[model samples]
Target: MIGLLSTTFGVSVASALLPLISVELFAIGLVLKEPEIPWWVLALVIATGQIGGKLLHYYAARGAIRLPRFLRREKSGKSSPGRWRAWLESFRENCRNRPVWAGSVLLISAVASLPPFAAVAVIAGWAKVPVSTFLITGFIGRFARFGVLAAAPAAMATWL
Candidate 1:
């Protein structure tokens, strides 16, 4: 659990630094003038960072708040555990016992993948998703995203 939290913190920081990292990698000649990081490395980095963030989100949600706490920065502060719990309560009537929780977790993760609301990591944490599952899913999703980013320029360069 502690490891997951730390990993997530590292991942979040990495995501925040992605633009600068790209430039540095380019300048360092790790990424050539062709203007793309290698697909495998890009996928690995994205997966590591995103999964780490998601794990951190889960731990944060699971950690009950205490008074007079000092945090480095505020959380994403969008939909929190409180909000999610309330929503679950209201929807409990129509929800079955088994599928509801897991389904909601996956659904939230999938939804978070969309733009302007990248909350998969946070949502997965709030939903108490298994760390293994979160990491696996995150890896797959991040790989797909990075693969697209890496491929775009190469594909277009072929035409040019």
Candidate 2:
């Protein structure tokens, strides 16, 4: 129980902070080694924790946008800032004008595990996507993604 809790917590925190790491795959692999426990339960726990962590990233990005210094820094830049600002403006505009497309992108990114979820969460927050939409889609995607990751090893082990 303690190991499960610790692993879930560690994966959640790491997933939130680091986009490069495949926390779901790692958690699935770790849980797979401990066959005493049901793998599905661990996968669900990891998925829940990961969703919670991603929410933190989403809110953090939202809060950062509200900071005066962040705005000032964006405005103060000449070359880099200009390019970033333009990109941000375009992203925001797309989100506002074509919400379905923007939301679909987020959903796809979450499910496919492409473009890294942390980056998608940050972008979704910055784009001001609906909180409910983000949470629901993120949960669905992460759950399926983790489930697949957890099942793959088991399937392979049986085959081998």
- Winner by TM-score: 2
lDDT per residue (tens digit) for residues 92-153 in model 2: 88988987887787778777868777788888887888888888888777777766776777
lDDT of 1 at 150: 50
- Tens-place lDDT per residue, model 1, 70-115, is 7535667666578766875544432334444554444444334453
Each candidate structure's TM-score, on Cα atoms with residue i matched to residue i, is 0.55, 0.78
In lDDT terms, which candidate is top?
2
Quickly count the clashes in candidate 1.
2
